[model samples]
Target: MATFAMSDQLLVIIDPAARQTDGESVRIAKDVLSAGAAAKVCLPDGPAEFARALGRRGSRRPVVIGDDHALLRAVTLLHRERELAGCGLSVVPVGEAGETSLTQSLGVPGGAVAAARAVLDGTERRLDLLVDDSDGVVLTGLAIPPARRVPAPEPVASAAGRWYRTLLARTLPARPPRLPAVPAPGPTRLRVQLDGETLVDLDEPLESLTVTPGAPGTSGGGTAEVEFRPLSVGAEATPLRACGRTVTVTGPDFRYRADGAVSGPVRRRTWRLAEAAWGLVLPS
Candidate 1:
């Protein structure tokens, strides 16, 4: 890990989503960052402009001011250019709490002010990455079968019932306690292999599969945790788990979710762990 000085040059790329979602937070982030460093701000309107701004950054450190998607975009670009290992990326998460969960999971501070200050005073920590065969990068973990979508509830017919429900909602706490929805299992068959050894065969029905990159301070440099649940017959079967450097999946066309984005209906896919493939700035 390496600490950054206040005099360092920074290229601050503010995502358009952040501006539209929370202008005040973005402004505060800009104020703090500019006050502490030699910062050049870029307000890119779309994906093309965003890539251009990042590509044009010379010796300046790149700092992203947006949600997880923006951060993923920056990392993916740098990884594609083979510059991710050398560049230390910083992010100021700006969006709904759920939307920025990936950034938080990677140890970034929550608020705009705190995250911005970290950019000036934090240390650069090397992080692991999972790169797929298609050149897709996964900053965080990915799920084999994408989450199922639940339809919205039917609207009430009576206006009086609607009013009563509205009143009940208002009377409850800001976030009323509710149990997490358990997704009903669907029929999915996938052949999973770890490090070239088969973990599960195509004959078995798979309920879910997940792959996550190893954390920073772990012993192995290039390794990821893999877990998958086999659909049980009478009783719920225990999920099989393993840690390895590479994972391969083959079966019928299936979609997967990586870093909150959905992709593929491809028949086969493989991912290999890249040890210390990127750097992220985090608080000391």
Candidate 2:
């Protein structure tokens, strides 16, 4: 890995969503970054332009000014191009509080001003990565059988308001709305293996599964933590847990949520832990 210097040139990519969501934060980040060091700012209109801008960054350290999705896009592109290990990335999260959780969890500061300062005056920390067979990268963690969401109940209105709404509904022409198609049920039986050893078989029904990268600077030696809950008839069974460098899952077809994105109905998938695969700039 190359040494990161404070005086190095920076390529700042401002995602469109960041601009649309919070212009003030974007402007603040740009101001702070520009005042600190030499930076070339690129306002990309879409994903294609963002990729092109990042790809063209020659010697400049890449600093993403957007939300978690933007950071994921940058990292995924570099990983796919085989340039991730050599690149030292930084981020100034500019989005809703909930949307920027990934960056925050990775040690990037919350506010734009603080994160921008960290980019200029912080050290690069190498972090582990989880790479799947499909070439997808998971920064934080993933959960099998994506979580289900219950819709919120309709809000109650006052009597006069309800009466007015009833009158308006009778007067206005009603059009049949196109309803969303419901998703099919997911696979229940899955075979799980860790480091070439079978942990669970298809005959055993699993309640849930989760996999996460080892904590930074830990003695886990670049292994991922895997845990699964088994469905029991009478009493709740204790969840099985293990640490391994590789994990494999085989089933009819299952969907998983990783790092805030849902992917795969893949019959089989394997993920390998890449020890210290990438670097992120964080406050010292």
Candidate 3:
């Protein structure tokens, strides 16, 4: 394990959500970090400021005092700049348990004191990242048939407006009338390809799909765990699981949730693993 001294200069970035949602946690994190090192704190109100804070970082190692989304945002920004590999990140996750699942899974402590202390006393370990063709990056996991985004209801027509529309309809030969959009169906059919072998083809309807970073020995941390459940009427079919460096999914337009953020509706998407592309600070 690679270690760094506690006296290293540190730049701490506090996400607005964390400070707004939990002020005490932020204070605790600041106290913990300052006690061990020369620490400077920056409060970024929005995404733009967040990027500026990271972009302007000097020799100080950057640490995030926020939840999973904040951590992902920082990582994504660094990835875009091609500096992720050179910069080792530390996270003192400050949010509700449900909101910081990714940090917890990565072995970061959930409590403020423990996580902050780890940030100062931890060792750095390299980790893999999932890069998509669209230039999006994922840290933890990706799942399909994302949580549906309910559309706002259309405005109702007033009595006078309705009457006017009716009169206009009677006077003019209506070109094909536009109808409201129908929602896409749930439990869709998807064709999944792992590395070059087809796992679930378009012929089979799928209930759901998940792809997570595989363990170190599973595939050298350069492969993802791909699993899909088949929709069936009888007993539930056993899910199919495989690992590969690249995973592709296609079939009618669909969306996916990656690291808690929803993206897509495209007909096809592919994610390739970059082995140990970045380093994370964790308790030794």
Model-by-model lDDT, in order? 0.88, 0.86, 0.84
**Candidate scoring better on lDDT of 1 and 2:** 1
Candidate 2 clashing pairs? none
- Over all chains combined, what TM-score does candidate 1 have? 0.85
* Candidate of highest lDDT: 1
RMSD of each: 6.1, 3.8, 7.1
lDDT per residue as tens, model 3, 160-186: 777887887788885564556657565
Candidate with maximal TM-score: 2
In model 3, which range of ten residues has the least summed lDDT? 214-223
Deviation in angstroms for 264 in model 3? 1.8
The sequence of per-residue lDDT tens digits that candidate 1 reaches over residues 83-119 is 8888989999998669899998898999999999999
Global local distance difference test of model 3: 0.84
Model 2, runs deviating above 4 Å: 1-5, 146-168, 171-187, 216-220, 233-238
Candidate structures ordered by lDDT, highest first: 1, 2, 3
Clashes of each: 0, 0, 0
Q: Mind giving the per-residue lDDT tens digits that candidate 2 earns over 21-60? A: 9999999999999998899999999999999999999999
